[model samples]
Target: MILVIDNYDSFTFNLVQYLGELRSDIHVVKNDELSFAEVEALHPTHMVISPGPGLPQKAGMSLKLIEHFYQKFPILGVCLGHQAMAMVFGGSLKQAPTLFHGKTSRIYHEGKGILKNVENPFCAMRYHSWIIDHEKPIHSDIETIAYTEDNIPMAIQHKKYFVFGVQFHPESILTPEGKKILKNFLEISYDKAHPLH
Candidate 1:
């Protein structure tokens, strides 16, 4: 099962739909709809923090919950969720010099990990005003997987944990091969659920 924590993002429904098409078992709830205990009752195999408007620092409750759940389960944070993950894990965020809404940028990434089979310098759909501060010292376990030409962090993953985040929206129509990126994420969760060793 997958638990989607909606942060009132307009794309929340689309994300749920995409996952539902991939897996029959998935649940989506607003960030405040369920308490931590209630979320535990659902037994979600993985969690997805959806994108939303505004700064992640202001999302006090969601950030706290995500911090508590990190490393305990696989998490895929999108946009605002990505920022929230960075902030929760000792990284910092600052307003981008230029806002990116419905814009496409080439994302240079490693050819492995969550971006396996994804093209390097792939065009990705971006929609956020804040970005991860690469200068800040993030947790050692965190590995930056992708970056924009301007040197902004575009994707990240926990080196030893099944946690990942993307600054761009892989579910958006503007992103070519978007579904493939999402499929990679599902595969990660599947591997976690059915580890070979």
Candidate 2:
């Protein structure tokens, strides 16, 4: 099962639909409405933090969820969720060099983890005003995996956990390889949940 924490964003359902294509059991709850006890009951194999408005700090339960479940389950954070993951891991956020609402950009990645087998410089949809601050030192545990042409961080993953974040909206129609990205994430989640002996 997969749990999706909706951060009051219009794009949350779009992301859920994309996930549904690859998984049948998915539950979605608003960031503000979810309780830890309920999450404990769901026992999701993977957690997806949906993109939303405002700063990651104000994302309600989403931030707490990342702090609590990052080590327990596979996590995929998108946009605001991405920022929240970075913030929890000693990373900081700053206004992007330019706003990228409903825009597209080229993404260069390390071709590992969720990006494995993905194109090196793929086009992805962007819809964010804030980005992980590259000027400051990122947490040692947080490994940046992808970036834009301007060197803005595009994707990140934890060095020792199954936690991942992406600044781009892989659910958007503008992103051609959106399904592949989500598929890769699901594969990673499956491997973590059922590791080979």
Candidate 3:
């Protein structure tokens, strides 16, 4: 089952529709007004923390839900969703060094986890005015995997958990290969990652 926290109503509604198209077997829960426990009672296997147009990295809203999901399922965050992960941990979000409000011009892909055997040189949708500082230490377990061509953090994953966060909108069609990337994460689990050789 897949759970998506309700944040921005318009964007989220469309994103939910996309997920349904991707996999019918996937179940989606629109968790608005439901307590974290109420949400937990549903027992979601894969969870997505929905993005919002709100302030960057809030301190309180849904911290319990985020912690709960991060501890248990394969979680993905988009836009504000990305900021929440950083802030919930020890990290934070700030006004973009340069505002990326629509689409990023240059993005170079590297590393090989879910992106392995995938093409290099790709672009992704941009919706937020904030960015995650990869150089900063959020959590000891945090590792930067993808970054902007100007040298800014774009994606990251927890060192041990199934927690993953992407600064871009993979659900958007603007991201040329976004859907494929999402599928890869769905199939790849943290258990499959090999220890450093």
Alpha-carbon lDDT, every model: 0.83, 0.90, 0.68
The residue ranges of model 3 lying beyond 4 angstroms of the native Cα positions read 25-32, 56-61, 189-197
> Model 1, residue 118: displacement in angstroms?
1.0
Q: Can you tell me which runs of candidate 2 are displaced by over 4 Å? A: 190-197
RMSD of each: 2.4, 2.3, 2.8
Clashing pairs for model 3 are none
TM-score leader: 2
Error of 2 at 97 (Å): 1.4
User: Which consecutive 10 residues in model 3 have the weakest lDDT in total?
Assistant: 188-197
Instruction: Give the alpha carbon lDDT tens digit for every residue of 97-154 in model 2.
Output: 7999889999999887788878879999999999999889878989889999889999
TM-score of model 3 relative to the true fold?
Answer: 0.85
Ranking by lDDT: 2, 1, 3
Report residue 184 deviation for candidate 3 (angstroms). 1.4
lDDT for position 101 in model 3: 75
